[model samples]
Target: MYPTHSLLEKIKLYSIILWPILVTQISYHAMNVIDTMMSGRAGTTDLAGVAVGSSLWAPILTGFNGILMAVTPIIGHLLGKGEKQEISRSVLQALYLSVVLAVVVYVAGVLFLPSILSLMQLEAEVAYIAKHYLIGLSIGLVPLFASNVLRFFFDAQGYTRITMVILLITLPISAFLNYLLIFGSFGFPRLGGIGAGYATGLTYWIIFGLSLLMTKRIPSIRAYRLFSHWIRPSLSAWKAQLALGLPMGLSIFFEASIFSFVTLLVSRMFTTDIIAAHQAALNFSSLLFMIPLSMSMALTIVVAYEMGAGRVKDAKQYSWMGIALSMLIITIASVFLYFLREPVAYLYTDHPDVVALAMSFFLFAIFYQLSDAAQATLQGVLRGYKDATVPFVIALISYWGIGIPSGYWLATQTNLGPFGFWIGIIIGLTSAAIGFWIRLYYINRRFSSLRS
Candidate 1:
């Protein structure tokens, strides 16, 4: 199907693509994990603030990031069709979209955020810290979105290694800044939970600015003429992107909203220690999650290229390859998490109560990680096919219709408490994973080629 390449050859191709993605995910996610750890050190209240704030921020971040995803698949499809020149317009349009979304998100976040937090009924001090944290974070949304736009442009051409290098290089600096600011290290004013927020915004803006400069200075990037001309976004492009991306945005929103809700409610229903534990356990789970997420993105690019080139069977091969690879890797990672949860939890915080609580909750992550891996891979495959709408609805139903409500019910009504919330997570992810795979199956059967 793919010019008779050996299984080893396929693995080689995938490996070339997958390694950078894996490394990048680690670095990218490390920023948040670092924040949680440092905030934990600052105090339990600070840690709870960061946790609750991140929950709200995750949905905003993930949803906007998903919407801006129009650029990557577009670039991949163009590359496959040998239409490299048109990529500049797509880049320009995506930038426009990114900036506009950034402004809207910032405004909406600032205006309605207080009311939302008020409803959560968090303690006065924690709420104050979270409110300020969102403010600092809101300022950086523009550059953050822009940086991701640049990432999509380069990553489409298999130049993912640069972004990976950038993030890895940024990771340590991010940690250093968090330490300096969170605790007033080196004579700096201690900002507590809000310090991580300020550090994050500044670091992200710096990354975005430097990345843009690199695109101009780097010969490889200059070849695309991405900055050669300014082009206004056309109606058709807007329609096309929104049609493809809105569902993606909503889908991501629904899934993240569940966790966000749980984090907020837990803060109200339990002590700051439980919130800290939730934050720490979540950070650990997210660290491992990057592996499957990276694999999924890489597969999306490969599958899009193959499908666009009319290599339908090759696309399918890569699809299965992606799924199998993720499952195997996650299975091993789960085993490691199973045995090492205590040490890992200890790594986040010295507080015995928080450590124990986080470790207990981590067992649920081990069980659900498999489902999460499958769902992530499927989401990517569907994106490659540009068939996001159906999966979007499925995710909404799975996560919201079933996941959040049930988790809330369990948390409120049952003795399982925090563990009950986790049980809901497992059910949601498992259902979404199965639903996504089934959607892909229908698409494959209905259309001979992936690009329908």
Candidate 2:
């Protein structure tokens, strides 16, 4: 067990982990911003294509990545228990699993993406860009998946700075490549928005290479010898990870896919300008979302470590602290979003109509920030406790069972038009926040009683 610490000490420790994580999360997500902004500059059709492609891609990526996230808590628990010997084996198995998942996602995308896009009934060029953008992205899935497991391994050990440094190194390279390929700058062929996908895919390979180097060369990490010994694929390990990870992944998928589904629904009903505007606002909102998301990720690590050591009280403290902090930061962020909505809208497109619609969407985005932060951070706290199944159920019911249907009805049936979908999102997130709060309360009581 670890020694007890004052709140100030805990804050310091948390900050050490959180700030790097926040930077990395923001920088990594900035690639999406780069994609949106650069492609927006190309043309509205390009912007809309990327947006729809992203709508199709983000949920799949998040779901699989979320599955890979089980590695973080698994390593966190092992560290808390001082089981250093098992770290390399667990991570290696996760890598093997990543390869398999990558192949599966790639195959599925190749087979089904065209059909999916066709169903959306997008314009011809828009359809081409969207299809090729995903195909380009699919090329990097293997590295992307593998590096994510490596990232989780590092994060679980409280080495977020390593990933942060790597991302810092990669972000500019990605942006430069995006510029070259998207606009045909410096003689690179003009791929427009489709080039963004290729740039992102190439960046993933670079990240994987750097991540492996860090694993092999870093003195402290080298002690784990993650590569010195290769553990053959083991069914039991796969089962263990899947058991914990599948629910967590599905929970994330449920939440993320709701937005994607909304985009798809919007694509069906809205004009290109409207779709561009919606994508622009949604993209900005997603960037802001990384703030709470980073907090939630940190909570998962710290809370898992505390819970693993049987310090339920400390776990509770960290959980509440992170949740409270997330709410506070998002509140401040919402204020900025309100004041700067117009400039922010202009960043995505110069088109007056798109900018106007995007600004309006920002209000709804602002309205949901608190509930979103609360629910997201609470999910992190529960994951730390190794409690995922119930949250998955809650997310599904809230997002699909309630959120989507409500949004669709409002958007289609009411005079609210596009705004109706935003309201549905508010309802869904608020419901999730309320449901997760009740679940955490019960979970806390159970763990506290056990501790007593």
Candidate 3:
């Protein structure tokens, strides 16, 4: 039994731990929502264009983020084990690696944007709009990469508040800029959807700059040179990180791709109203999903630190605590959203048909949050253990093998329509949650045995 004072202390500590993460998550999702709202004003075609373009971009971009995720645990472990110099070396190397990877991905995305959009079977006008947005957005990849590296570094050092500060500054600036640019306010040109993309790109640079400045202020971070003799990438280290990162990257790709793919798949079966409704519901779900997502990030840091310090019991306990907290928070959020689904759907658009469709999908979303929170937490636990491949395999099998096929069958082969597509998401997420939890249990057992 815990003492009341001790329990209060733990609550305070956890709140401090979660606050920055929560802020960052909220800011990021808010930016996305603002972008969507701005784009919707341009017309449904514009909205659809951004949606499809975003789907194509997320898997590729987030795959890179997955690589950065690999770095966090490594840095967290090193920080915990008091390998300050090694942490510095790894971070510098990771920064360089991230820049290189971002350049490659950006160039590839720009060059292929037209081709990819063309292949997506979008309306011609929508394709044109999406391509323009993608072109402007692609240029900011390096800055985005840099920002992620800084975020991971701070998170690893248990200084999550820096990200919150940077995001607080960036989010409003980005939204205001987006408003000005998208609507021709304040003497800014109305580039419409393209303007939103430009605003986002500029915001990425701002975040990168702010993160760099804050990073320089940290005594632990400032002790090492940004580019020193130890900054070169070790082939062995790269391989080790890749070995751990690739699976995680693929897992993220699989999961993000499923939603993205479903968006496209639904478009094939339904009209733009249905597609718009789906997007609105998805956007809301994604935003709310950030709560669990932040919890996952915090869990990774805490669990990895404990594990690295050889406190196996503490690590296990921390992971479980994080999961419980995430579930409770998400459950409440889901309930709130469920009760307010129609009003929430109206926030995206005024179209009655779209609102109705969105409200219908929200019912499915309510189910998704529980499973999604569970899967995300377990994935974080696996990250702490540096075990990625099994989860990746599980995501692929569940998402592709079960989720997509069922969605295709239900939406096309059956009569469930757009709701059927959401059912597919429910199935995929639930399966992933169960699979990941089972894998975590076995891994935890093995880890405990070894420790004993």
Candidate 4:
């Protein structure tokens, strides 16, 4: 095909896209670490309040972002076919969708925050703090989604560096804001956990504004005249995006909420130390997990672009190359986690019980390495083909239908204690990986046969 890159060239191209994403994830993880450390230092109640509040809020934001994510591949495929004009139109439709989605999400999430908090049966002060925090965060959802629209446009134009730089630039400022507001430092009121929310919301709005300016001025974006014209919602285009977005959004919600559900439902039965240990293991694994996730995102970009350009064979090659690279990297990384579980556990907390509890899960965590990588990368492969419904269903079945009940059964019904819950995660991830890999194989075969 006219747009085909050689295998070696594909490798280089993949690296270019992957590294920024990797760096961006790493940097964002750093921000999370800082958030945790600072919040922990403030007080346990503050930390707990933030955690509870975040659990309720994060999935909603993630689900909404999933809807927005459809635009990335849409723009990618368009760019691949040299359809610059179409890119402008597609992105505008994305913008319209974001506006409507943002309004709906913000209104619903904020309006229902109190009732949800009450359902959690949290302490009065904790509930109050969490409610206010959720409100603060909700205030910024529209701007956040809008920035995401700009982000997709940039990514499709092959300039992820803008996003990476913007995020990296925001980290220090965000950290500083949190610090000042959290502890009443620099003469700020000590709003505690609520401060974290306000700081985050304000930062998001600021970033959103900056993104708008950047979108207007960036050479690549300016050419699209993305902001120069008004774009109303086209039912057909919105429907296409929704078709992909709803399943993807639900899939993300399913996967992310499972862990939250485990923490909320299963953790109550365990000690605080056990919960902390599980969290520590989760943090370490999540940081390490970013590599595969980045590779997946890169794979989606490459595959979508190649497929749209009618380089079906190249699309297949990209998919497999990405899967191979992810599995290989994760395998090596998992070995380190298994062997150095102690030190890794120690880095998070000095509590012996927490460390012991954390150590117990390293084996299972190691087991998750290949399965998690496979599932995540396969999801990306499917995303390139705009195939989300199947993966979403697979994740639903694996995580909820299988993993949740299994973990609960083992944790409560069996003698496995809290460790049983983690075992379920392993099972679920493995099942999903198997399903996704199978589906991806068929998707690849179909794409590879696309010669006219």
lDDT of 1 by residue, 70-109 (tens): 6777788888888878888888888888888899998898
Best by lDDT: 2
Per-model TM-score versus the true fold: 0.96, 0.99, 0.95, 0.92
User: Candidate 3 on 34-134: residue-level lDDT in tens?
Assistant: 88878888778767777766777767877779987888899878867878777777777677778888888877876776676666677787777777777
Candidate 1 wrong stretches, greater than 4 Å: 1-4, 449-452
- TM-score winner between 1 and 2, please give it: 2
Q: What order do candidates take by TM-score, descending?
A: 2, 1, 3, 4
Pairs with backbone N, CA or C atoms under 3 Å apart (clashes), candidate 1? none
Instruction: Name the weakest run of 10 consecutive residues (lDDT summed) in model 4.
Output: 266-275
Model 4 accuracy (lDDT, Cα)? 0.78
The TM-score obtained by model 2 is: 0.99
lDDT by residue (tens digit), candidate 4, 1-452: 12545889888888888888888777766655555456556665565566666666656776788888888788778878878778888888888889899889777875776777777666676678777767766677778898888877777656777778888888888889889888899899998878888878777887788788887777756777876787767999999889988898888777777667776653446554565566667656777888998888788888888877877888888888999999999999998888899998777566677678879877777887678888889988888878899899998999899988898899888898877888888888888898898888887767657653
How accurate locally, in lDDT, is each candidate?
0.85, 0.92, 0.82, 0.78
Which stretch of 10 consecutive residues in model 3 shows the poorest summed lDDT?
A: 1-10
Record all residue pairs in model 3 with backbone atoms less than 3 Å apart, i.e. clashing.
none
Per-model RMSD to reference = 2.0, 1.0, 2.5, 2.4
Kindly report which residue stretches of model 2 are placed more than 4 angstroms away from their true locations once superposed.
1-4
Question: Where does candidate 2 have its weakest 10-residue lDDT segment?
Answer: 1-10
lDDT of 2 at 438: 99
